[model samples]
Target: MKIQTKINGHLREDEVEPRLLLVHYLRDVAGLTGTHIGCETSLCGACTVLLNGEAVKSCTLFAVQADGGEITTIEALGNHEKLHPLQEGFWEEHGLQCGFCTPGMILAAYQLLCRNPHPSREEIRKGLEGNLCRCTGYQHIVKAIEYAAQKIGSPDA
Candidate 1:
């Protein structure tokens, strides 16, 4: 199958198997390794990405399912020189230990802040329930999200 989609602000068309998982397409085909494949069962949020502005588990969807859609992987967020607030938050708050789940967690939190720029700690917890992190005990992750919310909502940001 030939699928065309916009990824990380670039339009790309590629031939892929109909059964190819989106996570595989991103990592193998598109060469975007930031979107990790933790639990292919979708139990782990390590495969999360923004599909058409909404966060979805890439492991749960086929590449063809994202045809004609806009996808944002963790690489699109920011670079080393300029980091997105979420990325900065993660770094500042030490939100990740192993760092395997950082990308998905940041993307999930990105969608959360987009929907509710100012999410309460509880709401942040609820918002990120879909993602699970074995390291950091989630306290630092919550603090990271809060840091991002404050930075994003601030005029200086």
Candidate 2:
């Protein structure tokens, strides 16, 4: 199947198998490996990405289903030269240890902050319940989200 979708602000049109998972399409076909594939059953949020401004687990959807949609992977966020607030927060707060779950966690927090820029710690915890991290014990992750919220909610930010 031929699917056309906008990814990271670029238009992409490619041929993919109807059964191809969106995560595989992003990593293998599109060469965007930032969207990780962990538990493909959606138990892990390793493949989370924004589809049309809402976060969705890429592992749960087919590439063809994302046809004509807009997808934002972790790469779309600010890079090393100018890190996104979430990225900076993760680093500043040591939110990640192994770093395998950082991308999805950050993206999930991104959606949460978008919906509620000033999320309480409990709210952050509730917001990120879908994503699980084996490292960092989640305390630092919560702090990272709080840092991002403060930065994003600030007048200077």
Candidate 3:
């Protein structure tokens, strides 16, 4: 199958097997390794990425399904020079321990903050219910989202 999709603001056209998972396409073909593969099942959001501006688990969808769509992996979120607000929030708030789930957590939080720029702690918790982190126990993760929300809601941000 020939899949053509815009990933991380770049247009990608590649030959892939029908069974190729979107996660593999991003990691193997697209050379974006930021999206991690934890369980390969949808239960773990470690493989999460934004598909057409909404976060979706890359491991659950086939690459062919993403053809002609736009995907945003963690690589597109920020670079070394300037970090995304969420990335900075994670760093400032110590939101991660192992760092395996940070990308997915940030992406999920990205969608949350996009919809609700001033989300309360409860709302933030609810928004990130789909993504799990074994290291931080979610306290720091919530703080990280809150930090990003504050930064985004601020005029200076």
| Top lDDT prediction, candidate number | 1
What lDDT tens digits, residue by residue, belong to model 1 across residues 29-141?
99999999998898889999999999999999999999999999999999999999999999999999999999999999999999999999999999999999998999999
Candidate 2 Cα outliers beyond 4 Å, as residue runs: none
What's the TM-score of each model vs. the native?
A: 0.99, 0.99, 0.98
Report the lDDT tens digits of candidate 3 across residue range 78-139: 88999999999999999999999989999999999888889999999999988989988899
TM-score of 1: 0.99
Candidate 2 local lDDT, 18-71, one digit each (tens): 999999999999999999998889988989999999989999999999999999
lDDT of 1: 0.96
Residue 126 of model 2, lDDT score:
95
What stretches of model 1 exceed 4 Å from their correct place? none
Clash count list over all predictions:
0, 0, 0
lDDT of each: 0.96, 0.94, 0.92
